[model samples]
Target chain A: MDKPIRVLVAKPGLDGHDRGAKVIARAFRDAGMEVIYTGLRQTPEQIVETAIQEDVEVVAMSILSGAHNHLFPIVVNMLRERGADDVLVVGGGVIPDDDIPVLKEAGVAEIFTPGTPTTKAIEFIKQNVKRK
Target chain B: MNLQERLAAGDVRALARLLTYAENDYPEAEEVIKNLYGRTGRAYVIGITGPPGAGKSTLTDKLAKALRARDNTVGIIAVDPTSPFTGGAILGDRIRMQELFTDPGVFIRSMGTRGHLGGLSKATQAAVRLMDIFGKDYIFIETVGVGQSEVDIVKTADSVVMVMVPGLGDDIQAIKAGIMEIGDIFAINKADLDGADRTKIEIEMMLDLNENKAWRPPVCKVVAVENSGMDILLGHIQEHRTFLSESGELVKRRARNIRNELMDLVRDRVMEFITRETGKKLTVDDLVQRIVAKDMDIYSAAQYIMEAINK
Candidate 1:
């Protein structure tokens, strides 16, 4: 049987504003995926460690704190250092279009900005989740 | 390297991969575990259980920290409920456990019940055993918020800590059946809340009526999020462990748990046998149709199945 995609919904910045993260977590659950919501104030190291420990196929993070330029790449790089680069890393929450290219350049699979529908994120995960 | 080799060499990724295989029940998992079964039985499993909105996760996190401070490795399997309609789950138990996320001594995994009825997933047994083989000094299996009759934690845990909060109920709620009887330690979490003393007293009253006095269950008041009273709670856990060993109850309990596990496996194997191809013309599908159409009673179907097996 095919496994449901396991996504780690985490907020990897200092921001405690997890409304967006919670919303996406709920959306992933409704779409028949297992979501491990790691709650707020998670650092990049914590996020990467969690991604490995949970063995998640996708790490969907939300950062409204504008620190994405620094933190997002750190998580992607850490996952690579841990040889878990196959995990589909994605991000959302207040990232500007200018930073999208930068984060994508750092190996983030995709970046969803505000106003992007939850269905889009769900579809993106379904299509890109790495299955070994 | 093969999974067993890497696992023996202390590979966390291999351990995590095997856990996934175990959770999914792939055939590969059985092969690995069958070979690694002999190395298990060293880890002490403690079960943390309570109703929803209780601080079970918080309690688990604090307890893991305490154990780590004592220089022990801890593996935590935290269970949450799956959505019955969508067949999905939001496993948010580890949200309370992020403090221990980067700690190498602690490994935390969250599980969804996955339509399993007893507040634990069917894969929980395998997860526990895998953690045992991974050389953890202690294992904590925190169940999904449980009500009466969801007591599968007993099958996996050497000691059970039933976390309770103030104002969950009055007299009738305090002494309810099924769950109230299983605790080796009754921890009144959220002890800063009102009526904490009353809740503690209520559980003590309930314990007084129990017939088993070999080890009287202790009632401890704790504020889990504050890290308050955990030393004493851990002391009680260690006390119970010593008591079990000194009293020879550990052997008997482990023996009984093995019995329950054997029965569970047998039931699954039998059901699989009955449902799969029988090499005969008659099938369970036909038997089910007949029963649903009222042409045959369920007892007749069972008899027919038994007879077919005999033939």
Candidate 2:
């Protein structure tokens, strides 16, 4: 049997709202990916830790709290520092268009803002995950 | 580092990959398990199983929290059913376990029954071994405990806790399902409900009918959602663990489990070999056709395939 794509759907940084995270998690599961969801109010450290422990190919983070500017890069850099550079980091949920470049430069693979179809993120993961 | 070295050094990534390989039946799974087999036997595996909607997951969360409170590192595996059409699964057991998400002392993984593969219990065993090799003190395997087909938990868990709610009105159903014999401890969750005392008494009455029993299964009342009475349940689990160790039942049971594991592995390998050989050549189908045409018997055809494989 082939190993299925594993993704971690995490909500980081005091985001009490998890509706978006839950939706993405269901979408990922329906896309045939194994999704381990670390529920609300997770720190960047917790997200990265879970991503590594779950052996996820992608970390799809949903943060509506506007802390993406501070937390996203920390997760990307921590993944890099821990020799987990292959773990692709993606962000969504209320991220502004202007911060896209900075988040991309910080090593986030892609950012899906509002109205982005779940398939777009699913396709991105299928296309970009570093296959072994 | 190689996979085993990385896993031994507490690399969660390595551990996760090893489990994936094992669950998917990749060739590396065998090599990795073989290399790390000696490092296992440390983690005490506690299985939490009950009918769906029986508060098994909530109880699992409370139990993990209690175990963590004792400074024990915990690894949890929640097994849910797989979707046949998409080969996917929605493992939402962690919904109520949000608190453990950030706890470094805990590691959680969800597995789909993957009905095609037909070995959710075996996959769970491999996951438990990985956590054990990673030095977790306790491992929890939670499965939707319904029907005899899925009772594989009895074979896998060191001490099984059969969680029950107050309103499940079938005392004889548990016996029919063979859950009564396998439960090392019974937990009446949702004890705040109307039938709390009645449920406890019912299970006790059923247990009283059990003969030739050395250690009686204790029925502990708990409201897992409220985190009430968890300490008492944990105390019972610890007591059972102690009894198993001091009475040498632990060694004996583990030895029996090892035998079962070895036999299952042998069967899996033999079946793998047969499938590989049969896939390359259409021998099995041809034999079946011959049998259908009344030219050969099924028994002889099976013997012929076995002989060909041996050669």
Candidate 3:
């Protein structure tokens, strides 16, 4: 059988509101994607660490604590430093439209804002996942 | 370096990648396992299982902690149920095991029992083998011990520890036939809770009813959160390991496990070949169409497929 797309749904940097992350995780699962959710309040380092350990093809971060600007880039840079730049990074949860291009420049493939449909994110992952 | 060389050099990323390959049953997984097969057979595999809410995760955390304290490098595989519809799983075992997260000595992975044709057990064993090859001294396989599916635990672990808690009436009755029979060591967790003694007595009584058994499983009472009775439980595991080795049961059990693995792998290969062949010509849909139209009976279709397989 074909290997399912492995996606790590992480809530980084003290984001206690995990309802969005949980929802997305479930959505990904329902879409037949293998998701590894590392619960709430994870660090960028821990998130990257888990992403690598899981050998996930995508790292989807749901940040509501407004630390996405700081945490997301650290995760992206960390992945690059670890020779894992090929792993796709995406973000969701309260990310501003103004910051979308910035995050994209920082290596985030896409961002699903608060009103975006979960299917959009799922499709994004399926389309953007870097399968080796 | 290649995966083998990196793994031999103690690279964590290499280990993780190998484990992923094994868990997904990727084609490269077989090659990886074959390459590392000679380096395996070193880690002591212990399977921890019990019904849901029996504190299996908490107990696994404590056990991994104890093993780490003794300077043993540990690998943990916590298996949770996957959604049959989505093929996705929310593996929350790691939430209870946060302490081991940052510890370099411990490598923890949570797997979903995707029910992909008995794939959970096979993936788990493969993960265990990868961890073993990576040089972990102890490997723990934690499963949601509900039904007969948990029999896979026995086939994988050198010693199987069944965790239970008191005050849940019919808990033993629910799992008695399958899980109860396979436990090498029984743990009544939450010993501080009421009926702990009664639960212990129940298991002891159950054991007493059995006859002609060379080794009897011991019941250990533990308050997992307090970390009490863990050392004793570890001691029992060590004792069981020693007994298995001394009695030559280790060799026998491992031989049986390998035989089962070989058979399962052959079955998987056969299925893969058939699927590939059917994809190219004579799709399963075509067979169904024939059966529906009464052009081919199901039994005859099976014979035809077998014949095709042979050809």
**Fraction of native contacts (fnat) of each candidate:** 0.84, 0.55, 0.56
lDDT of 1 by residue, B178-205 (tens): 8888899989999999999999888898
Per-residue C-alpha lDDT of model 3 across residues B8-56, encoded as one tens digit per residue: 7888888888877777666676687787689999999998988788888
The most accurate candidate by lDDT is 1
Clashes of each: 0, 0, 0
Q: List the residue pairs that clash in candidate 1.
A: none
Ranking by DockQ: 1, 3, 2
lDDT of candidate 2 over B18-50, digit per residue (tens) = 877777776776687678788889999998988
Query: Candidate 2's residue-wise lDDT over A17-126, tens digit each?
Result: 98888888888888887787757877777777777766678898999989999999999999888788999899999988999999999899999998999999999999
Clashes of 3: 0
Of candidates 2 and 1, the better by lDDT: 1
TM-score of chain A of 1: 0.96
**Regions of model 2 farther than 4 Å from truth:** B116-121, B145-149, B283-304
Model 3 C-alpha lDDT per residue in residues A23-85, reported as the tens digit of each score: 998888888877887788887777777777778889999998899899999999999998888
C-alpha lDDT of candidate 1 relative to the true structure? 0.89
**Alpha-carbon RMSD of each model:** 1.6, 2.8, 2.4
- Model 3, which residues run further than 4 Å from truth? B117-119, B171-176, B276-285, B292-295, B309-311
What is the C-alpha DockQ of each candidate? 0.82, 0.50, 0.61
Q: For candidate 1 chain B, which ten residues in a row score worst on lDDT?
A: B273-282
- Model 1 residue B192 CA deviation (Å) reads 1.4
Which scores higher on lDDT, 2 or 3? Answer: 3
